[model samples]
Target: MLVLKKVQGGESGLEATDLELVQRCLSGEQEAFAEIVARYKKLIYSVVYNIINDKQEVNDAAQEVFLRIYKSLDRYNPEYKFSTWSAKIATNLCLDILRKKKLDHVPIEEIKEVSSRLDTPEDEYINKEKSSIINQAVSELPDKYRIPIVLFHQNGLSYEEITEILKEPMSIVKNRLYRARLILREKLMPRRKEEVL
Candidate 1:
């Protein structure tokens, strides 16, 4: 997939950003839709799976997520942040599905995995404890908190940019970000204290 090129650090020749792919799709290039979906597949799937916590529901949500994207491609407003828009759609859909199914709730201690970053020496394991704790705390956030935190930290989006994607008041975004950090600190405080800030 062209997105694998993104993961491979630009070795592949995709030669476009996701917005550009949307542009092509809007202009009647249906094939371009596939490229855009491929680009975001991993991220979208990961987010959906974390919230749903059911394999079949996650898979169905993943497909429907792409379907919504495809159907909404015509209305894709380039002025807004794409990833935020995508996240909002995914989050709402998951919530709606949850309610419609009347699913029984389970324990919330979901253990999500992080993709391995650069390896460190064994001696540095303890040194990395704070970073690991912060990540785990973040992973535990409710979808509203977790999604914003992931977008801010993992996707490297600025607050203004995130504001557009979420279509949420900037104040709400800031509150979520602050609460997410505070929650992380509290969660990690007892375990370890280094590199928290």
Candidate 2:
């Protein structure tokens, strides 16, 4: 059995690298694969939720992503970062789900509010409203623009990693991200003005 002991202030406090976990998992240690799920479940959920935008579908899609990951472990390349590879799988799966369902206008109200210290309930409400507006704008974005922005900003993937996952040229990834930002700015500017007024 592969055991992971907790340590302070390091990557999930697990001593084993992702490759090590995968190796152990391949060696028939089920716990190692469980550990991998525990480590990355939040990430997979975030990627799926951002794309699928429906809370009901997010859970099913995330579960399916993990199942796919487990089945494809043998094809995992040691040269690449495991998180990147797994994110690519999640992204592709979510996209496939979207294509199959032909979903339109999914609401994004389920997006978690970013917590911060607020001096008053009014401030908290304002913050949440702003976040909701932002998420709404993001959800309205075209998929070509939305996917790159979500992977880059929301998921914190690097341009190179996104390029790899998206199989687009570096210039295309950068361009899409830039255009997404511009579109978001345009979408949010009127809201900002209304608040000021």
Candidate 3:
């Protein structure tokens, strides 16, 4: 096991390496597994939340993701990054949940209400409003485009990575992402013009 030291303010603190932690967990260390959960719970939850709008469903999906990961750890390829593998699991679980559920288009007013909670400067608020419009537009997109957009834009994944996660060809990933952006532009244009006028 590797114990890494962090130098903050010239004081060294110990940090456990992810691989070491994984190995320990594989060797039946419950605390190590807990550490892994602590490290990745938010990531898994965010990925699930992006696809599943319902908070309860998101929580359930996140739990399913971790359980699947735990069971399949022996099958994980060490060559790929752990986050990438975990993200694939999360994305797949979310897709499964989405497929099982009936989706409702989120109302723009609901988006406005959600965004209104944060008090920011006027310019920031305007920007956030614009962003909310864009989000609504994204939510309206067909799954083909929406999945790629969330994976590439929100999750910061590469086209190749998205291809692996979605089991689509690289060409398809690129095309979907491009089409998603174009659709968002078309959807937001009228609102943009209204704001200008």
Candidate 4:
């Protein structure tokens, strides 16, 4: 039974940078790996969930990502942020799973909407409906566009980071995101008009 340790300050009572944690893990500190798992579990899970869209597979995929990270630690380049590297691993794994399983359709209901406090029930309902519409549009995008959108908007990764993760040029990443938004706008325009009418 492996336990995830709480992320904490290093032995010097100061926060450890990700590089330092990786170095510690490389130095045979098992607890360091636990710390890494604890730190990145949510990120891995979110990336997996967004791509896979299957709640039942998310936990297993996240665990597999951690295993891959641990196994590939030696290949990690210190030039990149560990989080970025881990995200790349998660993204690749999820994409591979998608390819293998032929699972590209993400249900709108599975895409959790971020809710904010509203003045009335009507406002909340309208907000939820709009979110659902947007998510549904996004889900319909081609994988090349959709992956970048999820990474940029949902995962909050920078264009440069997404470029690194996806192994695409920065311009391509930016263009994909642009195209994705354009596609979404086109898809939602009629709905917006219907609501207004």
Candidate 5:
């Protein structure tokens, strides 16, 4: 859906020579795969952590994600776009983890990072409250809406690249992204403003 053109040029760190890495991995050289892993581990961890929550669980899921990538190296097709392919694996695994855990609802309030009773209690409270609300709203989104918003705003992916990653139509990408912001705004309204702007 999202056809990436020049609009996403500023987010440079995410892109890599994935094709070359995949080729080398497929040729039975493990070190090349390690380089690829090092390059993307943080990004992949963020995606997984968004779903799994726990640091240890996120680590395991992230490892499995790379392992899956390694196994699929031979089948990797350049035309499909490497980031898209890898993210699909990560998203699917996260879904599987969620399903296996049987989490009826997300515990978003608990995920916000708050200092342990540090000074400047006023600032801490404000930051905590803001983070908790945002996290809760984002956590409540359906995976479809959730993933796109996280990848777009949090991961700094452009709509075009997001379309490539999600493999959805351009309109659907636009609509869902639009809708996601609406949901977050509504969810946060009671605690903040009546309007997003």
Candidate 6:
């Protein structure tokens, strides 16, 4: 893997630098490509895992996402932010995998198992249960709602970016996000009330 960029004396930094790395990668710097992969791996992983809950599938899907991005880098438009463009690629790959597999629900036990190593046993169990419940509810949502929820809240994409990614209008993105929150609230509220009672 390529070394992550190092800031030298008087150099602004990677955050201040825009598409220079993309340009370098395009100009045949192998390290630049590795830097791109390293930079976006976590974001890509989060995007993939939010849609596909299986750990093995998540790793496979994430690798597939990077491969696709590498192959398609030449076609990348510098007009958009690199992170946004890459995130769109990640989201689409995840959606394609989910559609092909026809996964209907996220297994709650998988969520629990993934977080088994908590500092305290009681806290770990409680957090795991809560995560499982939330994930299950999210998994139950229809694709239209679920996609927006994951893209916006989980992945931190703006409605405009999501609009471009999903190829939907801004209004549609807004409506989906709004409705997703309402649905999650309706689903969780009763459970919360029961816990109190």
lDDT of each: 0.68, 0.83, 0.74, 0.84, 0.74, 0.77
Q: What is candidate 5's CA lDDT for residue 57?
A: 84
State every prediction's TM-score relative to the real structure.
Answer: 0.64, 0.87, 0.81, 0.89, 0.75, 0.82
Q: Which ten residues in a row have the lowest lDDT in candidate 3?
A: 1-10
Residue-level lDDT of model 1, residues 1-197, one tens digit each, is 34543312133664677677777777887667766777778767766765566786778898999899888877877777677677667767876876787654311223334546755575356545545555567656766677677667665567986677667899999999999778877887776544453
The true-versus-predicted C-alpha distance at residue 66 of model 4, in Å, is: 0.5
Model 3, span 1-197: residue lDDT tens: 22233212213545666676677778897777777777778777767777776775777788889899889877878777777788899988777766776564421222233454665798577767777777789889988888788878777788877888888999889988888789888888898799789
- Candidate 2 per-residue lDDT over residues 1-108, each given as its tens digit: 333542222366646778888888788988778889878888898889888877878888899999999999999998889999999999999889888988653334
Q: Which structure among the candidates has the greatest TM-score?
A: 4
Candidate 1 error regions (>4 Å):
1-20, 23-28, 53-56, 98-136, 139-144, 193-197
TM-score preference between candidates 1 and 6, better one: 6
Q: Compute the lDDT for candidate 4.
A: 0.84
- lDDT for each residue of candidate 6 in 33-85, tens digit (9 for 90 to 100): 77777778888888888777678888888899888887888888888888888
| Model 6 residue pairs with clashes | none
Taking the tens digit of each residue's C-alpha lDDT, what string does model 4 give over 1-197? 23365545668677577787788888998888888887888788889988888888989999999999998998999999898999999999998999998866664233445656544777767777777878889888889988888888888899889989999999888888998889988999999899889
lDDT of 5 by residue, 67-115 (tens): 9988888888788777667777787788788889876544332344546
Ten-residue stretch with the least lDDT total in model 2:
1-10
* Ranking of predictions according to TM-score: 4, 2, 6, 3, 5, 1
lDDT at 143, model 5:
73
lDDT leader: 4
- lDDT of model 6 at position 94: 77
What is the number of residue pairs that collide in model 2? 0
Answer with 1 or 5, whichever has the higher lDDT.
Answer: 5
Winner by lDDT between candidate 5 and candidate 4: 4
TM-score, structure 4 vs. true:
0.89
RMSD of each: 6.3, 4.2, 5.7, 3.2, 8.2, 4.4
Can you give the lDDT of residue 75 in candidate 4? 90
Deviation from truth (RMSD, Å), model 6 = 4.4
